[model samples]
Target: MVSDVLLGELAALAVLSPAAAFAALGAYLLLLRTPSERVVSRAVLSALSVSLAASLAIWGSAVAAPYAFVPVKLGHWFATRSYAFELVLLVDRLSATMMVLVSLIALTVGRFSVAYLHREPGFARFFLLLALFSTGMLALVSAGTVDLLFAGWELVGATSVLLVAFFHEREAPPRAAVRVYITYRLCDVGLLGGAVLMHDLAHSSQWGEVFGGAPWPGAAASLGPGAATALALCLFLAAMGKSAQFPLGSWLPRAMEGPTPSSALFYGAISVHAGVYLMLRVAPLLQRSPAASAVIACVGAATAVYGTTVGRVQADVKSALAHATMTQVGLMFVEIGLGLYWLALVHLFAHACLRCLQMLRAPSALRDAQEIRAAHAGEPLPPLGLAARVLPAALVRRAYWLALDRFHLEALQERLVAAPLMRLGRVLDRLERRWVAALSGWPERAAVEPGEPDAHAPGAPERAMAFEPAASDRKGART
Candidate 1:
């Protein structure tokens, strides 16, 4: 049997390996010019290999002593009279499994990207973000407290956004990145709120304290129905966003703007499964809250229906795969809500592996289709999919239109949420401009004439009349 101290060391190594690589690569990029592609690939691959080894070792130890749950305390971040924020790491069946999966997938993607993105200008930047993502995911899986998990969660989100906008010169990637960032930010409030609620109700956000020390799926949370329900709902909201559940899922298809490797890593595999991992980690709490479970089930069912309907009508392979992934993820959520925690975990693993493979091969789909047709003696491929065979003609046509328009979810969101927010932002911008003018003794110029275009409005020309240069400034420019 592995000693507890050895297990602690191994778990810490699993998380720190990638973190150290991220720091070193970041420093090298900033201080020195971009290192050779070989160097970047080696650094990232080596880190992932180490992390994977550590995770496997931890897993072996847990298997030797079935139902093992180990909590390793690194140190305290701060100490107060009532609360001491200690950095803790956990090694358990679920976490060890997740750590191994994340490390393996990241390593595979990093290796594939070397050849796939060869000669690309942003090679170093891509590897750097990949390293950061690996570290964040490792930390998220192994974190012992909600506070630590939240930090890791935010790190993952930031890296995701950066990678989505990796092609900084492209207009669409940045816009898509912004959309994803907004969705993440808005939903992350649930995680923040849940953390606060846990601290208040349980007096500690530590998993051991909140869910008890027993191993997961068997451990029971010591909370009243009311408290458990509230906390469960909040965490589920966070899960809904990360997993791309209904109404909040539109941003996911757009996320395909990033590189194929990134799309596979983030959407097809580990990143998309993060929410299911969270639900599994908190299975005990969900068991205690029937109301919360019902809500989760309803949302999951809706998303599953939505994804399946829209996926079939997608004209592109990547978009189709994105929606297909959403469909599987939604079913996983349904499994969790139905209290089939083990089944949900199995589904997550299988779907992630399959989807990752599909996404990696997505770019070659057209070639594959050609090969298939040639094998069939160049006969036109017969119609595939159940929709054509099973659905009534009228129903299929109606569904097609709805799916093609994505059920107008985006349009509704634009009118109800995004438009209002933009108007508010414009109002705030005008107020700030007026305040600045008052401070700079240009108050008169701040007043806008009726029907005149706002100088800062989109596509409107900059009005020189807004701020005429002073005579002394003009003379200085001439000299």
Candidate 2:
């Protein structure tokens, strides 16, 4: 449904601003030589400002009076006789909330990035990726179809990967990023599979019928029961992986390798909470799946407790923040699990604001405040009074231990995912070199050099990339 007040004018402007900004961004990027990071970063903030204004105008128009939004049909794809895809934008209550959240986060983080990435080597790359990420998120949140959601999902994942590996010189960032994309691949697998399954359920995935009330003869009634439960389960697995819940949660702490602002943008908001937005997008299906919802709750609870305990122990500011994000995300999942979908949205909104502020300001403020207090007093305050100042001493003691050990998840991952995978990989490497090589006479080329130079090898044309496993390591992968 569309707005009812100056609906045409508001919708027209909202649609135009983002499209115009994107086109301008693409054109300038194509022609430009070496753009200044400051200039580009400012441009990001400017675009965000404009987008926010445009979204507010549009929201002002969402009157209860009957209305509908017809998104510009940019393009389409056909998978089969029954399965067709298209890039059609849709603006409804759901899409609008996302627009607001994404715009707000982009503006805040975009501004923060200016100072954080300033004079850094990858500064330009950082801005470009950030801009692209925001663009994709805006599109995804405002989209009308599953295909559009997938496009936006890919965009978010791409931006996150770039940011995660922002410090490519280090082993940790790159390794963490690799693990990050592995989960992304898992997400794509589910989304693609779900799309196929959905088609069989409803003859079409068009925006007009899927979410509209009067059911399409055969759509799965509720994601809560039976076959619906299966779809819900798949969706849950995908969301868990993307949101960094337990089994796939390790990538996040390692994800701290990016610049502080990138970490702030991702872990603090935007990409990290993307799964929540996605779940909301399918609230109807989700509301039905009690068993699946139970799973979500369990995972959220597990991740929350684990993340909190670990976050408290972390000695480094960034790592502590990362685990804290895990804890809050778990809490967010609690809202989702409780079927307080609206509250989940509210929690996501408020929590993002508070956490980002705390992360960006807390580290130095503690030392500064304590030093000032100590100097003014010229003597230490009583332990009891000091304990009452902020948190209880017991809690602080707990946090100290939790943050330091990372709640032992590090050890768990090494044993379960990484160590086992490495051992199997070595065995597979030997097998491939011996028996497999005997069958196929092609000589193995080293991975460091990708291939014999092809036409696009020198300056490759950018294309939509799926989540693929990392092959060669720039810093980590101690082979």
Candidate 3:
């Protein structure tokens, strides 16, 4: 067996490498020092490469030994009267495998971006965010406590929104970023709520304490059914928002407004799969709650069907690919619900790699299509299989229309959820405005009686009479 100290060092390196790179690049950019594109790319890739090596070594040692997981604690971050936070990191089969994938994909994406965005404005900014994302993803995968995971989760979300707004000069990118940010905030409630419940139920935020100290993929859950159900539901809400399940799915396609490299890394590879990884990590909790598992299954199935229908009718390649990614991620969710934990992990890794490749090559799609047509002597390609071959003509037509409209899911969301929230927001704004006006004395001016003469009005009798008393009093005092 490897020494515990060696393993701890390796784990620390795996988490810190990308963070160090992020810090260095961010400092340089903030100081307004222009860094060469090659230097930026190399720095980011080198850090990720180191992280990948450390993660692989850890994974190899764990496999050689009898332990299913290895954990390390750097130090305590802070301590409260009731709760103490620690800077802990863990590596198991799951996290190690994901680390390898994340580093490799990031390296590829970073390399691609160095050229794809050559001489473009914000080139340094792009690498900075990419490095930040790498750090966040690694931290999240290895986090030993819900509190730690939440911190990593937030970092990933922030970088994602920023990447979506990479083209800040464009109107669409900012709008898309805002939409995604709103969705993230709404969905984050679940993660925060779940973390609170976990602390209350287990008396600790550590994964080991919460799950009875068992290794992942085989946790002996300690939380009761009730607690587990509530926690899982909260997490599911978070997952739906992050993974773009069903009604929240519109933002995924709109997120294509960013550069291709960002698009590939985020939606195709890392960010979109974060929620799935979270669920897999907490599989034991879901296993304990039948109600939560049922909800997960139902939602996964609905999202998968929804993604397929919408993907079929998307006019643009990127949008179509986004929906397709949502479909596969939904299947992964189903696998988790069915207790096929390892299968879900495998699916996530495989799908992420494949989708990233497809998205990266999307810009050349027209050229590829032309080549294919030429090879086929300009003949039209045959249709792939149809789902409604035996259905009546009218029914098929109706289904096609529904698919074209993405089943009206976006409209439903705006009407049922967004509209009510927007109205509530306006009402709150109005109330706040009135409160401010009252505090600033505007309300008193607005409340002036119409019959009362204006104090400053020219030739007003009331104004003259009001000043005459004061003037006479001053004169009497002087005399």
Candidate 4:
């Protein structure tokens, strides 16, 4: 949907192209993907690069207006009940900033993935997820509703899970992917419930409609403050899950098992920022709930302090980046909590770009440092040895150790999620055996084959077959 507006067309490109390119790339790579190569991955990377440029142009253009502006629309059929309000690519100040941040991060990480995942097994798969993530990020900014925005939000989670387990042969990658999924699912539930509440109250799902004072169909013109606040809390809970805020905050640190490109793209930038994006998207509605806003602020502040402290303890390059992402995200929450939505957008934008770069570069930087240490054993690399001015090494070390433990959330997961699953699994196994036995017949028994010896068998080798000539040969001989 190109428009007379130069900015709108660009926004359309950002919203639509990445998904299309990735889908095409995915198709091409289906025949070509192997451990040795991933054809056309580069093209998807280039698409994201172009998208990043477009995103920035739009951001710069839209930043002039603080409230919503830059309108463009496209419609798609999502299902029978609801027709897609596809793209109303509005780049009000908040969305503009988010667009720039997401595109930049997607572009940088796309570039990094090219080299880092070259000749790696999941190259095409990685690009597919990455491209989809890029598209979702852009589309999310373009979304004008809780529904459309959620559609985009879901793609981010789906793609992130695949990216997290990109190196599935390893033990850790699978575990990390599962954990990310579990947390994301929980978050989605809250988000969906809140969306229902919003629709019930506002009569329409569109952000403009709900916050702009449209009531739900057949509903009253006025909603109770308590109801609005409840909905706000529900949305905030979703934000906490997606953003890695307290309690739900621990998943990001363990998500480093994926390829570094994913570490850069999903965890470091767009994926982690999804929560903040949601929070900012509903800023108008959330503003009505002072209780919700205070909670958001409290969680964000706590996460910032906790993440920074824990980040001090991380020795791994990716782990450090994960912690950094959490710390910055927490700061963004602070911005949202404090009513400085636009300023938070700036932090989200700036931090996404910087963190992606930092994450993309970290592996090489650490390698170079290691090389230096090897080449000059006794000498200090002055910068590497310096501790943060605000926090000393001792405290950092202590915090790092605790952070490395992720405050034992893994153990808590076993109690809350895993142990129950294990018990359920045993029940399933029992059910399976009973069902299978009940479901089976003689065919199944025959398929199992008789382990028992035949009655004719007597622990002796069977007699060799008697040699016999063909009947025609015998007749010919007789004649």
* Candidate 2: regions farther than 4 A off: 1-32, 63-82, 214-224, 366-403, 419-479
Of 2 and 3, the candidate ahead on lDDT is: 3
My TM-score estimates for the predictions, one after another, are 0.90, 0.77, 0.90, 0.76
Residue runs of model 1 more than 4 Å from their true location after superposition: 378-383, 424-479
Prediction 2 global C-alpha lDDT: 0.68
TM-score of 3: 0.90
Residue-level lDDT tens digits of model 1 in 1-479: 89999999999999999889989999988898889999999999999999999999998888788778899999998999989888999888889889888998999899899999999999998998898899899989999999889988998999999988888796778888888899999999999999999999999978987898888775557899999999998998888888899999999988898999999999999998888899889998988888888888889899999999999888888889999999999999899889999899888878888888999999899898788989999777788778878989999899899998889998788779988997998788778878888999978657553456666667556654464544421110000
| Predicted candidate 4, C-alpha RMSD | 12.9
Q: Residue-wise lDDT of candidate 3 within 358-388, one digit each (tens)?
A: 9999988878878988998978887664766
Highest lDDT against the true fold, candidate: 1
Clashing residue pairs in candidate 1 are none
Better of 1 and 4 by lDDT: 1
TM-score of 2: 0.77
